[model samples]
Target chain A: MLFMRFRHLLFAIFALASGAAMAQNNPLTGLLRSLTNTVAPDQGKAAATNQPTSVMGVRGLDEVALKDATPAPAAVVELEKYAASAESATAAAKQTGLQERTVSYQKP
Target chain B: MTNFRLPVRFGVRFGVLSLIAILTSVVCAPVSAQTFNLNAIGSVVSGLVEGARVSNISEAEEIQIGKEISARVLGAAPLVKNEAAQRYLNRVGTWVALHTERRQLPWRFGLIESPTINAFAAPGGIILVTRGLYASLENEAEMACVAAHEIAHVNMKHHLDLIQKGALTQAGAKLLEMRSGGNEIKQFAIGQGAEIFTRSLDRGAELDADSKALVYVAAAGYDPGACPAVMKRLAAMKADASSLAMLYKTHPAPADRAVRMEEDLGKLAGAPAGSGLRPELATKIK
Candidate 1:
């Protein structure tokens, strides 16, 4: 249902009217594979209900789902400030070349 | 006699303990720099969990193949000679992945030494954008757009799927373990994966990545407009088929890609998107 808003994003999100719809299952991350829709999901489905949760603040979104809380546009200023400071914050990663800078992405 | 004996014993014990502490520092001094590396510790912990085999290709195997492919790519063209530019790329690339679902991948971003306008994503998050393309970016948001696009491809495992399709009979991760120290099968599979990059991904994959990249950039607080902005730039570039054969062959026409995003781009017109593309970093891209 979340994929509805992204209809303009991929034609694959909407399948052919008469043909058997192909589910483009991306098992790599083992997440969001179910979001691939065969038909145009109802625009009014869970949109309003899910809105508040989806764009809840920046890093405070450690518990949010990827589909629901990708990033609220309103959070842009905070995101920018975060990015601006991210370089200086990650300077330790720079000193070591590419040895290992990333901690495992913990699934919230 | 008892007091003297007890005093002597206490002195001897203290001396031995101090000697042990000195020896410990001497032995550990070389690796003192790594004692506080939380990322390394996380990697080791993740590496252990990564050993649990995935269905066809384990995460470890996928990352290993990505590294091999990276080496081949570097061998052919090498990374750009500019350290500042490379660091900027890593900074942006790392930022985008941090907001993605597959954030734990050993993600890396490099501006390979190529003048052709193109970007490549190998499995397990090894993303390379050509210097020609890097020079064309308008700001950090656009850079995030490109990195997010490639990161989306990795999340979808597009290249890994292609490798599997090409070598399913011998490319299973179980086969990798059965023949330990035998990377021939792995090499063959990786070779197939590398070759897949030489060709274009299916239209569905490319379009899907475009959509997700928008989400990624926005999720990272960069401008979603950058997605359409970058595409419009590519659409403007008059790439000759012979000279820019790889870019020409691999990607769907930029016009078509831009067309798909028109509605979303229109919606984002008034949205407050944040981006801080430093002038210093911008000039170093060359």
Candidate 2:
């Protein structure tokens, strides 16, 4: 019975080792491909649009992909509302004896 | 065989008892520390974890953070209050933004009512140009180049990276810890994050943004030479001028930047040498 138990333990260890080896071989390629697909679905479209492709080692900004891009109307409206509300709040705070300090850019 | 079984049982029991002791101390330590007002350890652990989590901020979170920072900036120095000028700036800025990777961002542009010749870009596509800087520009292209530079900073997530780096520090950690306490604490944490933006990004990031700005402007069908021209003008400014001091302090030496741009100018050869100032925009700003 002891010999049988020892054999079972060795088998379990071997199985775990092989599983780890498989995982190492397959690294996160699947996850990375999915992320790439989701983030940039316009790779083909960009190539066809005649955009100034990145030349001087700069990688991120693709002028072609942005050819048809426009600002979101909702975000613009929200920004305007925020500006108006912030203006009113500042005025009210000043009237209530709050000091208006310039935002400091000095290193801390 | 019986003797071997007895030892095995004892070993397992001893190991379980030791683990329980360790677990008890680990669970109770924080409560005991709190009772004694020793929250430094708690804050440190919480801050590091929070900082790591924020390093991978989602697109929506980035916009929210940018909004908070923009509000602080507006509170400090309000918009120029000229509707026509504001509208014109929005048009130009939106046009330039449309030529970059993140064209879909809200991309609001405002001219701040400040005499300091400086411009700022908050995350989520908010760009602010100072009245002094706008007044100094000779043409629409110059203004567009400046706006493009700020946009590059946003697109590259410079401010977000700075805030995340700040989070790893003691002050940042404490602020992050306070963020969980209540709404007031949350506001304070955001204010701290805003402060990080005001301090400026590293020199490398500033240069990278400058390079990207050239690419963006060139791609938008503007004369790429305008970027180096602006840098040369800035380089020639007197260091003591109050308007230039803040800008000078935060950026690399203008002369060095100009030299770098000169080297990279060859790469933008095919970009069109568009008109400096369009007739419609000229009369409005004037």
Candidate 3:
């Protein structure tokens, strides 16, 4: 009976170790992703077509994702374009001395 | 070693208790005693756990991006170049920034010529305070409070982290700094996620910035009582004008911040004999 009990304890320990390892591997760090994926099937298309490119415009949808796990792809595409444009602009600026034309804003 | 082993149940119990103790210690560790130069272990830990991930890019890359955006923004709509205000804000920001972890960064401070009531921190120690926010402030302490919080954002690398995380772009943080004449980029970046992240600083991040700002203002020998009063005034301003009015709109309302400030007042009550700004001088800036 003692040996059987020890075996059961070993299994529990092993289970806990595996759980920890799985958690370490998880990428969803900031907040837990809800399990139930009852996401609305077709919202990204509507948002992309209708929503203005403003922070507030997308916030309602972000809230939905937080509350109901409804993901929107429109935000992803917009963000990508924005980042790419900024990166290119920055690169272009570096190619020339574009940074020099601006008068120093700080006091000498 | 002698073959002495505990029962499996005892071992498991002991391990669980040890883990709990270690976690508690990690969470409860005080902000370091040394003049926390900001990149020390304590600050990095504080940032990782509570700092706002304002960008996803590397700090060096973010600084480069910030420099690029700042150059462009200033080129189009240059700061007023009012030497008085520039010197004043820089002096105050320098006081706060050195007290933070990322003190070594080439931080620059400026005042933009705009009526909009806002202040913001960009990557690489770049801070911009609009003439509007400056006019609204009643005293140097209030001004310091605002500057310190922005400095905390820089030190915590919140703006840069957000950009890297793809939540905010390099242009977005710059837009926050130069709101007036940045064209559509301002409107565009705001939609990119700055507003949501701006308004809702996680409770921990807010508290961390508050704590550091308070400590910095107090250490600089400004009136410690002034920080709380400034927060209360901002809360009132928000309540009257809708909370989103502040340039650095925090998600946790100013009232919530005021309450926290009140709770921390006891620790910051002692005023050192030094002075921050001459109110008379501050108002005299043309």
Q: RMSD, each candidate, Å?
A: 28.2, 18.7, 17.4
How many residue pairs clash in all the candidates, one count each? 2, 0, 21
Superposed by TM-score, candidate 1 places the C-alpha of residue B46 at a distance from the truth, in angstroms, of 34
Q: Comparing to the true complex, what docking class would candidate 1 get?
A: incorrect
**lDDT value, candidate 3, whole model:** 0.47
Q: Which parts of model 1 have CA positions greater than 4 angstroms off?
A: A1-108, B1-54, B169-185, B241-243, B266-283
Question: Pick by DockQ: which candidate is best?
Answer: 3
Candidate 3 lDDT by residue in tens digits, A1-108: 587568657755654454444332232210111111112213312222222222321221122222223223332222222222223323432342222111111223
Best TM-score among the predictions, by candidate number? 2
Candidate 1 local lDDT, residue B38: 21
The regions of model 3 sitting more than 4 angstroms off are A1-108, B1-59, B69-77, B167-200, B238-249, B268-286
Task: Name the regions of candidate 2 deviating beyond 4 angstroms.
Answer: A1-108, B1-55, B171-189, B272-286
Pairs with steric clashes in candidate 1: A54-A68, A54-A69
- Each prediction's TM-score versus the true structure: 0.54, 0.56, 0.49
**Inter-residue clash pairs, candidate 2:** none
CA shift of B62, model 2, Å: 1.3
lDDT of 2 at B238: 87
Q: Is the docking of candidate 2 incorrect, acceptable, medium or high quality?
A: incorrect
**C-alpha DockQ of every model:** 0.01, 0.02, 0.04
**Candidate with better TM-score, 1 vs 2:** 2
What lDDT would each prediction earn against the true structure? Answer: 0.55, 0.57, 0.47
In candidate 1 chain B, where is summed lDDT lowest over 10 consecutive residues?
Answer: B33-42
